[model samples]
Target: MILDVILDALLDTAKLIPFLFLTYLVMEYLEHKTKNKSKQIMQKSGHFGPLIGGVAGAFPQCGFSAAAASLYSGGVISAGTLLAIFLSTSDEMLPIFISESVAAGTILRILGLKVVLGAVSGSAIDVLWRFGGKKRREREEHNHIHREHHEKDIHDLCESEHCHCENGSIIKSAFLHTLQITVFIFLISLVIGFCVELVGSDKIGYFISTKPVVGVFLAALVGLIPNCASSVVITQLYLTGILGAGQMMAGLLVGAGVGILVLCRTNKGVKENLGLIGILYGTGVFWGILIEMLGIVL
Candidate 1:
């Protein structure tokens, strides 16, 4: 069982390489080439970030949430946008649904719901941030950094990731960065996989399935695992009639496809990270409970 867990973890981490590499490639290009225009646009379109993040994160790709974490750490995007991406990220849910031969319409509905909720939750966070005036200092700092030495800002991010490839060719830099994060992700996935194996998914499913009221909270907790297995377990439970739509979504919404892992490692400040996690957990539970109360079947 342990060996199988290791192998499966490796295999799952391997699947993320292409998307991760491509995301880094795009980041490199933006940093090296379109830094000016992209910065201008990113700032100008800041208000729409959550909406855009929701759309991008809802795609089948696994790296948007990870990339969003890096962007947020660099102060390139707001926390609301990061939360939006995390909430909407589908991780392994779509692939599992397709493999299980689930109805296409149902899949679409779930994806759509996630995207909408992601945007709504993100926008709300942003509003609260601005209303509380907590966003002023960060925005000013980001602007000052950009006005004086933008390249250093980008390099600072590279330093955070410990890639130090900022001075190299864009392709080389991107590759090194990708490899660094991929290794970190692999280690995390391996540990989580081994733990899950020990605890046993069957036992987990039975517990949550039997207790509907408590399941939302527990399901959201499961979603916070920061691995694909969270989605796999949640989806499997729902398909087996052990979890309803809202309960499955609670897990899925919190399953940000390793985004949480990246966020914790790359982003600074433990308290801030904890706060974001709290917000994300609250959002998932609120939506799940609301959906259940509405008796909305998907």
Candidate 2:
């Protein structure tokens, strides 16, 4: 049984790769489009630029981190905007939407939630930044860096130093990144599937699926631990009727919410606004309960 569980975990992880790859492609395209727009807008007002920046950042699946990284390195966005987008966006939604047996209504609802959450969270960040009144210092620091970079560029003339490449290069990079990411996701999913089967959702999911209130709380907490594979199992249980939609969404919300917090801490040029995270989590639970109530009404 132990050996079987281990094998299952390995396979599930492998299964996640294809999905991750596909998400990478979509994210890359969104990233390019967003960057171009943000560049134009940031030229006008740096603070207002994050509104669009957060929305754009939310579209990509796996590459939000990479996109966020690149944007930060380029000094294109503020930490608040990056955090808002990270909290609002999720790559896992694509596969879930495409998967057979998953409800179209549920997928659409989740997608809609993504947009709302991204905008709301981003706006909150902007408000906080306004009150903090630290933008002047940040902008001055940014200008100094920009000036230094320009000066250095004039002094150090190296033809080979041009790191920015053509569209073809970006596309190729995105494609390869997607391919590797997809393969990795596929493996993770496959292993997760096997492990859930071995442990039986009834044994695990059952305990957590009770007490709507506590269930929702635990679902989010459990999602905090590493392992994307477990999400597959948790989501499957929900779809299969072993768990309720509310429970499933609760798990997803926690996973995405806490996941963003964790990433924000580890990542540079990113800091999450706690108020925004709370709203996202609260909204998730609200939606989850709404779905449950709908079942009774229908």
Least accurate 10 contiguous residues by lDDT in model 1:
145-154
C-alpha positional error of residue 54 in candidate 2 after TM-score superposition, expressed in Å:
6.4
On the 0 to 100 scale, the lDDT of residue 167 in model 1 is 66
* lDDT of the structure predicted as candidate 2: 0.50
The segments of candidate 2 whose C-alpha lies over 4 angstroms from its true place after superposition are 1-60, 69-75, 133-204, 242-246, 257-298
Per-candidate alpha-carbon RMSD to the true structure: 4.1, 8.3
TM-score each candidate.
0.88, 0.51
Q: Give the per-residue lDDT digits (tens) of candidate 1, residues 219-273.
A: 9999999888888899999988889877988888888878888778777668878
Displacement of residue 149 (Cα, Å) in model 2 is 20
Backbone collision tally, model 1: 0
Give the Cα lDDT of each candidate: 0.83, 0.50
